[model samples]
Structure formats: structure tokens, C-alpha cells
Target: RLGELASLSYGLAMTVVAMKTVTPEPAESGALVARLETLSNAIERLPRVIPPRGKGEASAAPPPCDLQDQIAALTSQMEDVVAGGPIERREKAPEQAEKGEVKKKKGGFFVSGAFSDPAYSRFALKGTAAVMISYLTYTLLDWPGIHTAMLTCFIVSLTTVGETVQKLFLRIAGCLVGALLGIVSIVFILPDTTSITSLVVLVGLVTLPAAWIAVGKPTVSYIGFQIAFALYLCILQGAEPGFDLVVARDRVIGILFGDLVVYLIFTRIFPVSTLTQLRLDLDKLIRQCRDVVKTKAAFDPAAGAIQEAGRAYATLETASANLAAYGYETFHSGNRRLRAQANKLAIKALRGFVNALAVVAAFPPPQGDAEKSEALRQLLLHAEMNLQTLAFSLAAPFDVSSGALVDSMPPALSPDDEPSPQISALEALMARLNNVKMTLFHYRRLLHTEAGAYE
Candidate 1:
């Protein structure tokens, strides 16, 4: 299931990238165009269909004849609008192309580069070393019963040491819990169960809850699988139900040994810290938020920008979730508490900024009010520039100072004069932007302090 989810996410991300890379066709209007053409043709044939009105019979002008010219004119105008849309898009294409170029320039590394860094190689190497060590330990020792040690390595390995450690702890805890349950079943429940029906009922009773937990949130879901595993090992030990304490003990020991090996390897060897990755993820998310603002400012459809921002947000959230494993990380520099606090603040601020952008997107620009439209555009531009600076600062090395924080607010538009919905929406967006800047400023300060402590 997790693999399926990952595959879906990857496919969605690729789709978004493709959508951005390919120039979309102008808004679909084939149906409208066909309807207009049919109307125009019918109007052209109308005069031919009607018999000529005799002058001798009441000399009143036919209403259909009178309106034929007007109908034809309206149809022609509609057709022209529909036909000219592509021309308008073609005229604006160069300007859009220039904007796209500017976006690419300002995007920096987070936007243009692959998600994985050079540390990924180290990550792979560490995981391989762990699995190999586990395999050699069990195989050389001729301990076939403890082969689960090798299996554990594969299941617990993750991109960052912190995430690996987190999973390691989860695996161990779940194994212990499941083993205890299995032991209890072997001691008490197995003796009472005689028929296969009774054994089936007993297994179902245990598995029902385990499956429930497995289907729950990702963090705790592994526990359920482990519970079921341990119970099965103890309860079902062949064709028929047989109590096997020795096998259960060996499996549990193998799992624990594997986890220990992985933990040591990941921590001691070129450890990929989640804290560092969290900073990078935060930077990516900030830039994504900036992209959202840029799209809104350019009067472009924001669906793609919003989708990217959402993906970035999820990435950051996952990183933040792994922060708990910092306690298990060895040779870690910087104050973990401060780093976690900074991360939390960044998440909160970005979430607000994304929500505000959504609200801004909801309200269309004021119609026939060029001044108000321009004012909103300026406000969005201001927000975008500030976000860009923040993202850049975040992407910089932690030891390097980020200069002054972004305290300058976007110039406020006079809501009294315009008092339009667009102005109100922009105001809300500015408020959120201010909150984001302040949070980022605080987050950076926290990081500086952490860096100083490490130095």
C-alpha cells in the first residue's frame, strides 16, 4: 500500500511537471464556435426560406426580415471573438515566455534541481552496508533461524538516518509488542483451542486489531503488521496449529539484532541528518509559495502552482514528522530543540501563506478598475519578491549570516478609495505574507543561534 501511494504521488508530480513544461492550448471553445457557425449559416438561409411578402397584401414589414441583419451581425461578432482568442494568445505568448524565463532564473536550486542531493549516495551506501553486515553475521555464524536480521535491514532502511532510526524504533517496539502477545497466546489460549475453528477464531481475534492498527496513520501502522507477524509465528508453526516458543524467540532476536546493526551503521557512517534535509525542504516550500504568488500576480491560472505548493508542503510535513528521531542521532551538531522549533514555525507560516493565496485566488480582480487591478498586482509582486528572498536565505549555508530579516511590509493600498473585493482579498494575502516573513525571520534567528552553539 505504501509503495502504491508513492507511485501515485510520483505520477502526479510528473504530470504537474509536464503540464508546466508543455504550452497548453487556448481555452476549449469548439462547441461554442460550431454553434455560432451554425447560427450564422441558418441566418444566411433564413431570407431564402421565407416567401416574399406581397405588397398587395398588408404592407407590414416581417419581423424576421427586420431582425435578420441584427442577428447576423451578432453571430458575426461572436464568431470573431471565438476565432480571435487564439490570435490574442499568440500575441501574449512572447510575454508569457519572458515571464517563464524570469521564473526559471529566480527559482534557484530548489526549483530547478532534482529532489535528491549528493548525500543520497551516502544514504544508499549506508543502507547497503547495514544489510550486508546483517547478512554476513547470520550466514557466517550458520544461524539460519536468525535470518530475520537480514530481512529487518531491508524493511527499516530509509533516505535519512533520522527516518531510518524512527522506523527502527517503530519496528523494534512493534516486534516486542507482538512477541509478548504471541507468548501470552502460546501460554494460555493455545491450550484451550482444540479444533481448527477455534484456532481460526483465536487468530482472527488477534489479527483484527492488528490489521486495524496497520491501516491507521503511517507512523504507528507498522506496529499492526509486526503484531500479526509475531502472533502468527507463535500460533501457526506448521500444517496444524503448534506452539513454537523457540521459533518466535529466534525471530524476535533476529529483528532486534538487525535493527541494532542498522542503527549503528546509519548513525556512524556519513549520516544523512533529517535536520539538514528539513531546512532544504523548508526552502523548497518557501520557493513553492513564491511561485504560487507569482502565478497569481501574472494573472495566470494558479492550479499548477497550487499543486506544487501542496506537494512541497507534504514533503516538509514528512520531514517534520521525522524530527522526533533526532534524540537517537549520534554526533549531531546544533540544538535539536531550536531546530525543531524553527521548523515548526516555518511550517505554520507557510501553511498560512498557502491558505491566503487560495483566498486571493478565489477573488477575481476588480472589473473596469485599472487602478485597483494594478494595486493588487503590485501587492502580489511585493509578496513574491519577499518570498523569493526568504527562500534564498533559507537555501544558503547555515553558518553564513542571512543579513537582515525581511521586516519591510508591502506598501498598503488605500482600501478607503477602492474598497473592492479584490482589495480586501489582497489585504488578507498581505497579512498572511507578513506573518510568513516574521516567522521566517524568527526561524532564521533560531538557526543562527544554533549555528553559533555548534561553532
Candidate 2:
């Protein structure tokens, strides 16, 4: 049965290939195409003939026409069709014409624009330097785990200076806790564990919490991994009755040195400022919001606008969180509070903007309602114009207090309809717009205050 099925499948597949590749228009006779198609249909309908499987049973006779021979003939005809056929010549004619006109550039090994982009190139150079320096330093010191030290550099480094510093502190603290745990485990618990079974079980048991913490908060995740590393280094090194504490010590030192190296490279050399990042992200969010509001309501929010809004929101949030780390800075510390407040307000405004876009997308323009339509258009225009001004303010330092009080206010988007559930969403959208205006007002005031103090 299997042999019969295999033959049928082969015949069916080749039949399809022949039908697609062979054309009768260029053939000498159209009857040949029709006969081939009929032969394919007959082959599909032919029943599988299974031979009896008793001892010394004779096999069934094969089909009258050899299927392989038929397939080979069809393949040869297809080759002929492709070699000198009018269709093949027509297809290649255009390519031959363009080949003389267009000169293709020679291909060679090279870097493209994507690799040269400042986003990647800046970090690529810095990170490579950190890794190379860490490895070289550890090699000079004759450390046991020089690879771990180099890996630690990458683990702690972040895009911004404040973030890198914050992670460095966490890495050091986590490594110390982990190293202490390793010491306790080796000294008290596994002192005489010659049995591999007992050692495996105990190691697994201790690794549970580290694994748990590793999956938790991003701030402390590295600590969990470090703890496991420290424990492994202490318990797994050396081939005696017990591993030495010196192995764990070396690893801890290497980690500390790696973190120090990364901090010096990332923080002191063209360090990224959280405030500058926040400003840039906020400007991007403002532009996306403006475009979303100006766009006509459709079945859904514009995908580009929504995507940009999401990225902008995430970047701003990250920058805001990193900026909080600088609150511990001794220089211009008073401004940190004002910066935090502005960040909080800006985040709120951004959330409101996203929600407003959602609402705009949910309910399209009210057709046949001229008054409501005109009011909505005017409101959107006013909001867009104000947002443009705010975006400019974020990009460049400017006196915010000089703007007219009335111009700073949000445009009224009050629905004409009476109170009902049908228009509750519309009402809420207007409220969110009002909240965004209030948040922007406070944000501007905070910026002005910070600027004045610096002056």
C-alpha cells in the first residue's frame, strides 16, 4: 500500500509541474496538451493495487505506461519550451535592454548606513573599548574568570550616564550579597559533601530563589544572576574535598573592576543627560499627538501615529526614571525636584494625548451635524496649534510666562447633546483634553521657575 501511494503521489506532483511549465501555444499540435491533461486526470483516478503479502506471494504487475518515462518526457518538453520559446525570449528582452543602460555598482565588503548611524556607532565604539579594557586588565591581574569580567561590563552599561551609574550601584550591591551567600553555603552547608547527588540537590535548592528574583524587577534581576554566579564559582572551582573561598573572591573583584571600568567610560566620556533625552522624547510625542489630532477620524487611529506615540511614551518614562537617579547629585540638587515635577506632568499630558487620540479614532466625525462638526474642527485646530508651540518650547529653552493666559488655555470641546451614555465618551475626551492643558500649564511654570533659578 505504501509503495502504491508513493507512486501515485509522484505522478500527481509531476503532472502539476508539467501542466504549469508546458504550453500548447508554441507546440506543433494543441491536441498534445489536451491528451496530457486527460492522462493526468486518469492517473489521479487510478486505484492503488496492493500485492498480497503471504510467504512467496507474487508481486502485482506495474501500470501499462511507465510513469517515470512519462515524467522525463514532460520535463524534456518543458526544457525545450524554456530554451527557445517566445515567452522566454520576451521575458529576457527587457533585461537585455536595461543591462546596457544601467551600470551596477561593484559589490564589496563594507559597512552600510544602518551600522554607521550615531545610535549604534556611538555605543558600539564605547562598548568595544570597555570590553577590551576589562579583558586586558583582568588578564594582567591573572584573574580566574576574565570572561565574566568582560561580560559584566556589557551587563552594567546603559545608554545614558545616570542609568549606567544606577545599574552599576545595583550590580555592586547585588554581587556583594551574592558573594556572602556563597561564602555561607561553602563554610556551613557543603563542608563535607563528597557525594555528587547531595551536592546537586543542594545547589538546585539554593538556586531556586535566585531564579525567582532573576525573573522579577529589572533593577534587581542582575543581582539574582550574580548571586548564582558567585555560588557556582565558590562551589564548583578546585577538585579537592571542597572548593576554596579564593575563587569567589577573584570573581567578585573582577565584577567590581568591570563595573568601575564601564562607569568611567560611559559616565565621564560624553555622558548622556536624562533631561536632554526627555526633551527630545517629549518633542517627538508632541509632534505625533499634533499629527493624530489633525488627521481625520477613521475606522481606527493612524498606525504610524499610535506607534510613534507608544515609543515616545516609553522613552520619556525611561528618561524620567533615570533622571530620578540624579536627585542624589550634589550639584544643582534643588532643580531635581522641579525636573521631577515637570516630568510627572509631561507624562500625564502624554497619557491624555494618547487617550484623546483613542477617542478621536473611536467616534468619527458626526456627519450631518454642521454645528458639532465645525466646533470639533475648531477645537482640533486650536489643540494642534497649542501643541506645536509646546513642542517648540521643549526643543528650545524659552520664557513660558510671556504667553497670554487665554492662549494657554484649552479649547472647549463641549458636545451639544444632552447628558446620556451615548455621548459620555465624548464628554470624557473633552475632560482629558482639559487635564492635558492643566498639566502643560504646570509643566511650563516649572520650566520657567527652573530657568529663573539658574539665572
Q: Top TM-score: which candidate number?
A: 1
Question: TM-scores, in order shown?
Answer: 0.67, 0.60
* Model 2 stretches with alpha carbons more than 4 Å out: 1-125, 143-147, 192-197, 238-242, 296-345, 356-360, 364-368, 400-455
For residue 365, what is the lDDT in candidate 1? 28
Which candidate achieves the best lDDT against the true structure?
Answer: 1
In candidate 1, stretches whose alpha carbon ends up further than 4 angstroms from where it belongs are: 1-125, 302-341, 398-406, 451-455
CA lDDT, candidate 2, residue 423:
37
- lDDT of model 1, residue 291: 66
Model 2: per-residue Cα lDDT at residue 32: 51
RMSD of each: 13.5, 18.7
Give one digit per residue, the lDDT tens place, for model 1 in 1-455.
Answer: 22322333333333333322232443355764586567447544443233433334333322211112222333443333333211122121221234357332455545433456666667667878888898898889988778889899999988777678778888888899888988898888888888989988888999999999999987678888988987787677789766778888888899999999988887677766666766666666676666667776886533344454555557656655654554345325557666666666766776766665655543322346577668778888887777777676666665434444544656776657845544565666677767776777776676566552112
lDDT of 2 by residue, 64-120 (tens): 222233343443333222223221121111211243685444466754564667856
Model 1 Cα RMSD, 1 decimal: 13.5
